[model samples]
Every structure is written in structure tokens, then in C-alpha cells.
Target: MRLFSLRTLLVCTALASCLGMVGAQAATKAQPAPKPSGQKVAMLGGKFAFTLPKDYVKGPMEEIDAKARAAGVTGSLYMNKPAKRVVIITETPLPNDQKVGANDKPTLDGIIADTLQQQQSSYKDFKKLGEKKIVRKGLGMRQLDISGSVDGGRVLSTTITAAYGKRTAMVNVISLAKDAKAHAEVVKGVTGGK
Candidate 1:
């Protein structure tokens, strides 16, 4: 028969518990940090270029092209982020023979209206965060913040529409997660620097 002393048993149990706690902590510490959405974002074309977080990746500009085609509009640019990435959508109003509208400048209402049409989604989904004037490097600009979800909970996007002259450009920065604060920072960086 083998017998263990009480002191030995106590010491062994304590060591085992300590090891278990350490192992649990180590497992947590070993886990990788969550990755950024890698959505594509736009920067103001001026003295410098600003961008979204690394997790955000650029989506195809094809949607912009499609909108231009459907609206019978010309010379429009669209930039989208990768899947689940936030995107910025921009539209420009230029002299196009196909366009029946007559507006010297792009209006916020008009732009948003077109966006709903192009995306084939109703404006009801967007919760408007209001409007503000942005002045960057002595250049006066205006921007609007809008956000909503898409793709059956797979993709969520926050779009910041910024207009310049006869040309309008929108940047849709999106992610699988909702991030109002980060989106505001992105809008600030894009609007303030441009």
C-alpha cells in the first residue's frame, strides 16, 4: 500500500490549482485581437489623403456605375468597401445630355434620393444624424451622416456623403458591426482634411 502525507497532498493540490489558473489566463492572452473590418473609405482630394481603419477595405465602384446608368447620368464615381466593410458613396452632378434635371449644384435631398434609388432601398432604413458644414484648408464643404444595415445582418454600413462643386462624391464606410463613434471620426478625417 502507498500512502501520501497530508502536507504532500496539500502542496500538490495547491500546485495543480495554480497551474490551472495560469493555464486559463495564458489561453486568454494567446487569443488574437479582433481584426478591423477592412472596409474601403475615401479621402478628400486635396493636399493630403486620409483613410479608414485597417479593418476596412474598399468595395467595388460598380454600384456607382450602375447608378449612373440607371439615372441616365454621366460622369459619376462610386467606391465601395469590401464585404462587411464600411463604404463611402459619392455622386456628382455634371452636364449630361441624358439627364433631364437642371440644378446648378447638388442638393442634399437630391443626392440622398438618388442613393436610395441606386441602392434599391428605401430611405426609411437610414437614421439621419443631421448635417454640418466642414471647412478644410480654407475649402468650405458640407457632409451628411447616414447609417443602416444590409444583406440580412451580414453587412452594416455608415455612409458619409460629401459634395464638391458640380461633382458629388460619397464614401460609404461599412462593417459587420455598428460603430457610430468610429464612423464620426472617419467623417471628420475625410471632411476636415479635404
Candidate 2:
């Protein structure tokens, strides 16, 4: 039973550095965290909301935080057992000292490139399936689809990154490569895409 840990995948997906900063911020924050209302999980002070899948089980934030701490990444985890899929939502604050322009292309591009490199090094027979720039709910996001072999089975990873104000939210989905189409549909459903 080779369980492909999403925590491990997130660490190798270039989210560790950004997430490390988020972890530090979390420790120093004085305000109490807000709990999710119903099916929507609030992120970035309610600037973002992720609609949970109807059939997926949501893990406790404590467990998610502990895993992130162990992996040096920050994110909330949602899992669908029958589908063998994991969806993670991570938020990282942009550097406060520097002035970031609206829709900062260079910064986002750098993150994308770094993530691609990390994926290549982390997985066996890694291949970039496709990538595209898209707008979701008026926010610009970069989406990447990557396929690789994990524990003798092919896996597909889809990562979507969007910048909002002084923070960036990343949503990553990992599923068996054989379920690529189904996984895509799942993403579309969760994101409210046609």
C-alpha cells in the first residue's frame, strides 16, 4: 500500500519556502482564527473561499497544520477516499517590505518556474502535460498539469496559483493518472468552472 502523501508532494512543489513564511506569520498573529462556515472554507481573512466537495472528507486543521509544520509548508487538506485524490489549499503572504504591482507577472512567473523545476526533480518520469493562464472569479491564475510515476503507478498533479492583494493562494490536486479526466472534472466542479 503505497500512499502518495500530498504533504510530501507539496513540500517538493516549491511551496515550502512560501509556506515557511506563512507558518512564521501564523505563530505571531494575535487574533483568533475563523472557522469555516458550512461547506465553504475561508482563507486569507475571507478574501478567498473554497467550496468543499460533497463527498470528500475534510481533515481537522490541527492535523493539517501539524503536517504542514512537519513538511515546512502551509495548507488545508481535503481528501476523497474512493477517488484516491487530495486537494490542498495553501495561502502565503507576499513580502510586506516590497511594493508589489497589481497582477505581478514576474513574481508569479518565478514561482511557477520554481514549482516546475521542483516537480521535475521530485518525481520519476515527470512530464509536463499542459499549462495555461486563466481567470477565476476575476483573479488571474496560472494552472499547471503534471504527470509522473509514483510507487509504480502514474499520478497526475494539477496546481493552480492566484495572487490576491498581499497573499497568494495555491490549490493543488493529486490523483492517479488513470483518473486524469475525472480529476479535471472534479477541479472544475469545485472551482465552479464550466
lDDT of 2 by residue, 7-98 (tens): 34553442332233333443332322112223676664564556665666765444345554554335676766555666777766554433
Candidate 2 regions exceeding 4 Å error are: 1-38, 60-73, 95-102
- lDDT digits (tens) for residues 68-183 of candidate 1: 54653222222222222234344444334323222213454555455434433422254554555454554444454454433223223344444444444455444333334444
Whole-model lDDT values for every prediction: 0.38, 0.60
Cα-based lDDT at residue 58, candidate 2: 68
Q: Number of clashing pairs, model 2? A: 0
